[model samples]
Target: MMVFTKYLEDFLMKCSTIGRNSATGRLAIGVGHESYESSHLQPSQWYGEVRELCGLANRPCTFPCTNNLSPSEAAEALNDHIASICQQLPPLDTTRLPAYLPARLIAPTVSQFQVLQKLEKTRVKRGTIPLDLPMHLIKEFAMELATPLTSIINASLQQSKCPSQWKTVFVTAIGKTQSPSSFGELRPIAITPLPSLLCESFATDWAYQDLAPSVDRRHFGNMRSSSTTHCLVSFLDFVLTHLDKRKSSVTSIFIDFKKAFDLVDHITVISKAAASMGIRECLFP
Candidate 1:
């Protein structure tokens, strides 16, 4: 599943279009489901597809809670806070940094990635908020710095025409293993033309919007059809909406019922839902 997710991410980064296709009236496909573990059966379903689901909400939240720390634990808590914030900062490495700053100044300042060069001559210790700094004040500073740093760094490296810049950004932004040659063609999630225009429309009924949930059994035949795009996007949007929400939380539980499909015990789920809707069916052959 990890391999599949990685491959899918790579594929999305490439061949997919980001703008409206006047030729086909379709834009791009939405992909859900991160590859967490491999399974013998496919993960898609009719009412809800499991494969495209994000694992965040079900996983455990690890962020250190303020309620559990002591006076001396403050530093450790601060480190946790810094680590969480650092994970979101733009990539940093020798090739991507300003030509002037020393390598020693990189990591610490990378938490403040946009302004590392600005403070190379000054000493801002890592994990140590200044004495006079209030907690909110430091957070505000980090947020303020994060905006321009991200904008400047992204603007500088996002050009597909420049191989050198793309290579560096590719290695830094996505990961070293990802190929820069194909990186330029990569697309960010849901930023495409069709999806962008219909963002609101799709948000309401993501799964039912375009393709039938059953289409996963085969490749899209009329791949260029507008209906295909809408359906696929809706299916994907459903997954992304859930995943996005999950990503913001900090805990998740991944359970694989020994025979998930065969032993699902769907009778309970079906009966309850159907009963409320005044419908009844065995729904099984």
Candidate 2:
């Protein structure tokens, strides 16, 4: 008994000494979230594993690991690359916009029950995780976490003030080639916080439900039962039908803009989204 207690104390000490900000969740009673086989391993067996994972979250994500950059240097490189991509786009002029009826979007009220449902449905294997926190912990403690999460989400909706952490995302650069030499060659995948992502889904559903009528039926991308292939097939069918009717030569033009999303005026995006939600001036949280 004495030996076991001593070992427990030492184990706690090592886990505490890890550089991670939140170690309590990692030290839970059950096994690590990874695998069932790990459950039978002694603390010493897992100690090295946890230690290996400790500083990994903070590791510099530069391509070609040989660069041997400090975290700050890597971060600076990422910022410079991102800045180069952010071409300033002209803002949309509201003056020329056609007038539309004042339509109010009444989103369904969020409840703890609904939040719990969302939590219960969350799977641990989601590709994206919170920028800093582990998502599995929340999903594991869903019952205990639901109330607080519900309150926070409800408050955010009411005040239209989104937490800064929710808006912040980290980019993970995946190599496109066998040996990625430059940042340009790497595909950047943005990972948003689990909570922020959930909130986004809620907002999307809320806005889509109300704004569905305003959207064009032909605008099929990102909608259910629609794909780029489906759009192309439909266009081809229309062209064939027109030719059967003996119409004149059909003209088709395609334009592809480089870094289109990066060039978008985000202020315009936020203002437009907010106006659609029946709020003016302040952007959606």
Candidate 3:
């Protein structure tokens, strides 16, 4: 089971139409079956069928909330459940600065060239934002838009606050298995605004240089060239070394945390990360 916001359909439609024949009228059957001509029917008429062929919306979920609840009720229930688990941070402390950090820890100013540089690598984008401005359009106007974007980013950094619009996000709930009976079985993936994501990239780079030395070698999740496969390989090598080469018994235990990411203390993380870079003032508002 999978749950997606309405924005996903729009995003998929846009993605599908790019460099491909998404016209539902072209939908056809292989052998000993009926076929349809492009001129015969409207694409929207076969929207679901066309999407199926494209491997989109394969897990069409009518949330169990559909059983005995209205849309508003389901939304409220999901929101409440998410809020209960996701530990949102307290308001920003703007009045004072930590003694060890610099008095002002504003984000760095970005140049138009810097913006263009990042935009030019658009082809290498690893993530996309849902419900925000279209990334395709943003890439199309990258050059002409860089200067103003740089200005906006610089102003945002100087003021130490981001636009409220960036706060809006769509959370897609994906189930771990074919049938998910409860919210606990679903993983919430938050899709953010493009600008907010871009800003995060820049800010993360600010701390990257200072944060490298402090990172533990065993940490395999977010570091460069580290992935689940790499971790697995390392674990296997460790077991082999201990059991075969070093003549020791191998023992291990795996612990699973329910909705681990939802309980993150993000404010403390940001504070520590910023402080590591000699940045004292709060940037989030």
Separate clash counts for every candidate = 16, 0, 0
Candidates by TM-score, descending order: 3, 2, 1
lDDT tens readout by residue for model 2, 1-285: 456545655775675556235423334333346432234444454554443444222343446843788888987887678767774555456554433324243334588888888877877776765353455776778888878888888778767678987887778777776567877777778878877877777777766665676677888877867899888988998888777775556678888976667778866766665556444232233
Report the number of the highest-TM-score candidate: 3
Full-model lDDT for every candidate: 0.35, 0.65, 0.66
lDDT of 3 by residue, 1-285 (tens): 124434535654564465245443343432225443233445454456545544564685545644687877766777777877754545445444344334354456888988888876765354565564466777888899898888888888877678898888777777765576777667678877767777788877765656667887887987777899989999999998888855569889999976666666666766666666443344444
Estimate, for each residue in 1-285, the C-alpha lDDT of model 1 and write its tens digit. Answer: 577656655543342343223232222234454233332322222102222442212332232333365855744544444344435534334343223322232211122442433333223332221222343443446556445554443333232122232222111122123332322222212121211122222222332232344345434544435466676777676567777884453343546543233333344534443344322121111
| Candidate 2 residue pairs in clash (backbone atoms < 3 Å) | none
Candidate that beats the other on lDDT, 1 or 3, i.e. the better one: 3
- Candidate 1 or 2, higher TM-score? 2
Better of 2 and 3 by TM-score: 3
lDDT winner, 2 or 3: 3
Candidate 1 lands at a TM-score of: 0.16
Best by lDDT: 3
User: Number of clashes in model 3?
Assistant: 0
Name the lDDT of candidate 2.
Answer: 0.65
